[model samples]
Target: MGRSFKIALAQIQPALGDLERNLSLHEKLCEEAIAEGADLLVFPELSLTGYFLKDLVPSVALTPESPALTPLKELSRRIAMTIGFIEEAPGHFFHNAALFLEGGEVRHLHRKVYLPTYGIFDEQRYLAEGDRVRAFETSFGRMAILLCEDMWHPSAAYIAAVDGAEFFLVPSASPGRGTPQKGIFANAKAWELINRAYAQLFTVYIIYANRIGYEDGACFWGGSEVIGPSGECLAKAEYLHDSLLLAVIDSSEIRRARTMNPMLRDEKLDLTLRELQKIQERRS
Candidate 1:
């Protein structure tokens, strides 16, 4: 027996650029999750404004004090909540940010570091890149957030692990690709592998909430999932449909996994740092 809590992942479709409607949807989902006895609720990336925001990014960008998030902040007093949105920083800069709200306040904010610009993705054209990745303390424990493309880079997960994150929350709007003949969307499989690998490597619970439905011509596959510290899928939502996936995470598993596989304990941080410095110097 260990400290356990249930989390709900809202795998829903957001109307493109419909901020008011999206807020209402989030409110409804939060109420439903609360009724279901969820300790936390997670929404997909750009959930407030939808993905594929090109020039419209500025129109829906929100600051920490934005009135648009008032209701969500209020909801967080009862249960922890996280949602992704376009964050408006100083000087008109915008970022794909995941906001963690708990105890009626904004607890932590993670801006997307790697903005995919290849193929169907073109985030770099509209958003600024986040410079750092770190974990923060929460009521549940130390946690970290990685938005969409950030999870693709191993260094991002590594940074969070080094920062003592016990849980990883990833919000994504990844579009579906590849045929069924290839076995579940190739993109979805990649995400699953990434999530499972990180959970095993860092001995942390991984919660991935992805959006569903079509935006323009691109369809997002909504296979939101919860992976345990042992790299096992605890629960998964339906593909191509809006769903509320729930799972319970046992905090004790993290300790057990870490003890069983002493990778973290045996890591040579100083050597890795020195090597990285040498690489940087060589590049410079």
Candidate 2:
């Protein structure tokens, strides 16, 4: 019987470039989640500003000291929260970022490292990429955040796991594609496989909160989910709808999973480093 906490995933549809409306929705959802007895509430990527934010990035960019965040910060005094937005750094550079708030302050921030620029996505043209991936301390436990495409790269989660993160939060704005007859959406199966693999391999709890509804022509598939350390789906929200998904995670499960699997225990860091050096040298 180790630490256990209830987490809420708010799968929402955000208004494009409407900061005030999005902020209000976040406040409402935060209160709802708190009423549901959630220890933490997680929202989707670019939650404050809808996806397809090309020229709008500059207009919606928020500074760390922006007064607009005061209400959410106040809400954190009672329940922890994580939300995404466009961050305006020095020299006019912008980053897609997630903010973790607890005790009326921002405890940690993870900028989206991998920005998808292929097909319908054009993030590279409007945003700067984050350079680091690491976990930080929280009221719940050691936790880490990875936004959308960051979870697509195995290295991101690997780094978080190596950095001692026991809980992983992924906020996404993935569009629904392919035949719905196959599954919830075409990308749904892919996400399920990716998340379950990460959980099983690293023995970490995973919370995936994806946005729903359409932005311009793109449709975001809302299938927010929580996966256990052993790759079990604890809870999943319905597809193509605004939902509040909840799950209770026990820290002891990580211990049990690691003990049973021992993948992390038996990892060969030296070998991996050596191979990575070889690959870099070969590339050069």
Candidate 3:
């Protein structure tokens, strides 16, 4: 028998700068996921604070030990979770972070490494960028976490895959933009292509949970989905609507995919590292 686990994607809207209300929504979604027997539940990036937080970022920032997050810690005892929030780090720095809460403890904390400052995104102005990326062990196996904008860089995914991550949990708050392509927003379609490419190239499961709602006249298209190691779209939530999607993942499938592809087994990490070192020296 292959190892398998069920996951729930909570694709809901967060109240702008309203931590109390968003915490309530998280609790509600957690209860639903538990009722459905899901082993893991994922929420979108900044799930506790809506996107477009210009100056309100500091107001909603919370540490991992904040009393406001106590309920989520309690809920983690029943089911594992990946939830995003504004993290108040040391030295008065704030980060766009996600926590893997399991068994009433913070299993892993991933601060978003890439902070987008172009277009409508101004995260760098208010949040400090994370400097690390590594996969962590979990009951389901090795997993990695990447927030919005971080997925746009292929290096992050490559590092996680090489580090033995079997699955990537992506939390995003992307706004819908550009003309419609394939009956969906261009950004959404672009994300689909990227997620599929990463899953197929790395031969790992991509569990993407994006939010849906209007903030500051921008609409977040929630096309949350789960892609298998074979680049197959297993389960997808509705676009521009609140939805809870469920998908079951099997490790045997990952093994079979890697065996057939063998890309990871053939990677030249040392050669890449040497070249990277040379480039860094030249830049210096």
Ranking by lDDT: 3, 2, 1
Tens digit per residue, CA lDDT, model 2, 53-102: 88989999997679999999999998998999999988888999999999
* Per-candidate local distance difference test: 0.92, 0.92, 0.94
Q: How does each model score on TM-score?
A: 0.98, 0.98, 0.98
Which regions of candidate 1 fall more than 4 Å away from where they truly are? none
- What residue pairs clash in candidate 2, if any at all? none
lDDT of the structure predicted as candidate 1: 0.92
Off by over 4 Å in 2: none
Clashes of each: 0, 0, 0
Clashing pairs in 3: none
Worst 10 residues of 2 by lDDT: 177-186
How good is model 2 by TM-score? 0.98
Model 3 ranges off by over 4 Å = none
Residue 173 CA displacement from its true place in model 2, Å: 0.4
